[model samples]
Target: MNSDWLAGGRAELAAERILDAVRTVFIDHGVSGVGMTEVAEAAGCSRATLYRYFENRQALYVAFAGRETRALIERIWRDREVSVDRSPAQQLLDQLTAVLAEVRKTPHLAVWFEPANAGIVAQLANSPGVVDALAANFVARFRPGLSAPAAGRVGRWVVRAVVSLLTLPGSNEDEERAMLRTFVLPFVLDEHTVID
Candidate 1:
């Protein structure tokens, strides 16, 4: 039993080490440019060993993105500057803008925004786990009265908006802010509200 427990611990450690290697490779080469062989080489493991942890590049991408997304959410929550007293619309805008700025500044996370990898990132963002995290953060922190389903819907819209901005950025930050305020704020705050 002790030996089995040790083996499981070792396996978990190995998987985490592999993910660390994946982060380095993602930073060095954009997420789309990386492959199983590159990950294996970076991890100092045989291809077969790497495969034991991640079945394919897509699986690896999903895992990495999930990890990064969780970290980003935690960072957003940890930010002392994010005042809770702000209006729902203002809070959502602040959070969305903060997420965009953080992802752009973090090289490992930023690689996913490259045009080649945007589709993959968008697909991953739609996964239930990611959507739930976004919903929980938005509901519990920003809008306490929002229903779970409502939060999920709003969260997905916010994510789509963020992904769009990341993929095809506006002319400048001012323009981007204007676009979010004009297009996203109303819909996110009130589902029935339509923007003209």
Candidate 2:
């Protein structure tokens, strides 16, 4: 979206344009490095206009993450194949790995997990907001029978695991997969094992 579209009665479009600009800026400068002023210039708008859309950098980050999470979920499920032959563990592996792969592949999203920026992510996640909602929604697809609260517990656990691996990966993808299979899968994939 071009800056010309940032006029009256187009608040949503203007916000999206700002976010698009932020994504580009994030690829060059890690999430922590991006500033509201830089985003304004990138979006071809004044700092006042940028602030009108997003009160602050944190607000912008939340909006971007919220928009992208829904889109990411769609992409993840679009490529997913459900087969009776596939074991539950394998399915969980595929789901988790797909998330890790997608996050790593997306420059804007990956920047959040960069070691220096991971702390910012952690700070945002401590509150029961986007992170909790994202994790719950992601896990609920696999454990549809679990209640909201139960799913939340499992989801928080999954987010922590993902963040840990993203910030400090194991030796390689193979090793990371092995660790997830051993430590993370059973609890999340096995309904018999209660998560309290």
Candidate 3:
């Protein structure tokens, strides 16, 4: 891997391109259903080349999760779907709803929530790294003055809510919104957010 990288190939760019290919494969075969060979083939790279970038299935999963989560979060905020005029609680609700909608619309992401893949999705979503990043970026913007650990706790709860909903959505958006209002908002925003 290093030798090829040293020979002038951009490893990061190669890895990202492979991941892009991996997404369409995941769409065809749910995240858990896709094998490494399938990934390598879809990436149009030899298995050795794929493994050079991603050591194994788990590494690929983590890399994919990190990349996609960051992209999704960036898109949600960039869209400005959550209005400034709304209360923080409403804004939070809008953000959560936006995440669900976004994921559902994207085939690769939607497949990740398939019943067979839900366990893997849950594990990755609840991982400390994901939670911490979400806390530092997402939670911090809403729950200012909270410590990193505190924000992380909030982030974990949010992840749980998201995974649960993704795995088993409610009958309708109203019900989902209500569930978040009843279950999520209290714990996440239990402490009043200090807006500046």
Candidate 4:
């Protein structure tokens, strides 16, 4: 095999190994508690090798968030496609439930809320290329009257709210759903209250 091709294959494998390590670290230690040294040790690679793949801790966190975010968007899209007969509200509720549950379960999801991880949070807020694309597509389907930009903004807000709730210690599912209906959905919909 060509040397360039061999090197590229190895690089891809190394990247995967590092990402798997990142997942473990993020789960074991919250985003605020994890450091590059821990991630390197978890991956069984030197700090230099980890740095080559990720410039800094913030960059690694960004990659971690990006990976999980993509998986979530894909899941939502897949579920929606299968529910072709469902009403828009029902479809959206299903998608939101799945995505929110995953975010709550994923350790790195806290990255979005940690002030120290501002770099990662800025990436989500300022660029949000992946999140934006998913929002635009999904919003276009469910809320046709709203522009893509509006939907994207609402999507970001929902994500932020979810992160806030996830970071707290003891909010149950019923409480979360109530909070969503009371505090979140109404604000997005521009409603004064949750009628009935």
| Clash totals, every prediction | 0, 0, 0, 0
Off by over 4 Å in 1: 1-9, 81-85, 191-196
Better of 2 and 3 by lDDT: 2
Q: What's the candidate order when arranged by decreasing lDDT? A: 2, 3, 1, 4
Judge candidate 2 at residue 58 and give its lDDT: 84
Which parts of model 3 are misplaced by more than 4 Å? Answer: 1-8, 81-84, 192-196
Residue pairs that clash (backbone atoms under 3 angstroms), model 2: none
The global Cα lDDT (0 to 1) of model 4 is 0.65
User: What is the lDDT, from 0 to 100, of the residue 125 in candidate 4?
Assistant: 50
Question: Compared with the true structure, what per-residue lDDT tens digits does model 3 show for residues 86-170?
Answer: 9989988888898999999988888888889978987787666754675466877776778877777777767888889989999
State residue 113's C-alpha deviation in candidate 1, in Å. Answer: 1.4
Off by over 4 Å in 2: 1-5
What's the C-alpha lDDT at position 90 in model 2? 87
The TM-score values for the models, in the order shown, are 0.83, 0.88, 0.88, 0.69
> Model 2, 60-154: lDDT tens per residue?
88888778876886788778877689887888788788888898898888888888897788866565666677688777777888889988988
> Is 2 or 4 the stronger prediction by TM-score?
2
lDDT of 4 by residue, 1-196 (tens): 1224225557767777788888778667756678888988888887888899899876776666667777778876776574668655555556666667776565556444555655545555555564666655655565556766777776666666655565552366777676766676555555332222
TM-score of 4: 0.69
Q: What does the lDDT come to for candidate 2?
A: 0.82
Tens digits of per-residue lDDT, candidate 1, 3-112, equal: 23225557767777788899999889888788898988888777888888788877777777777777887788679356658777777677778888898899998888
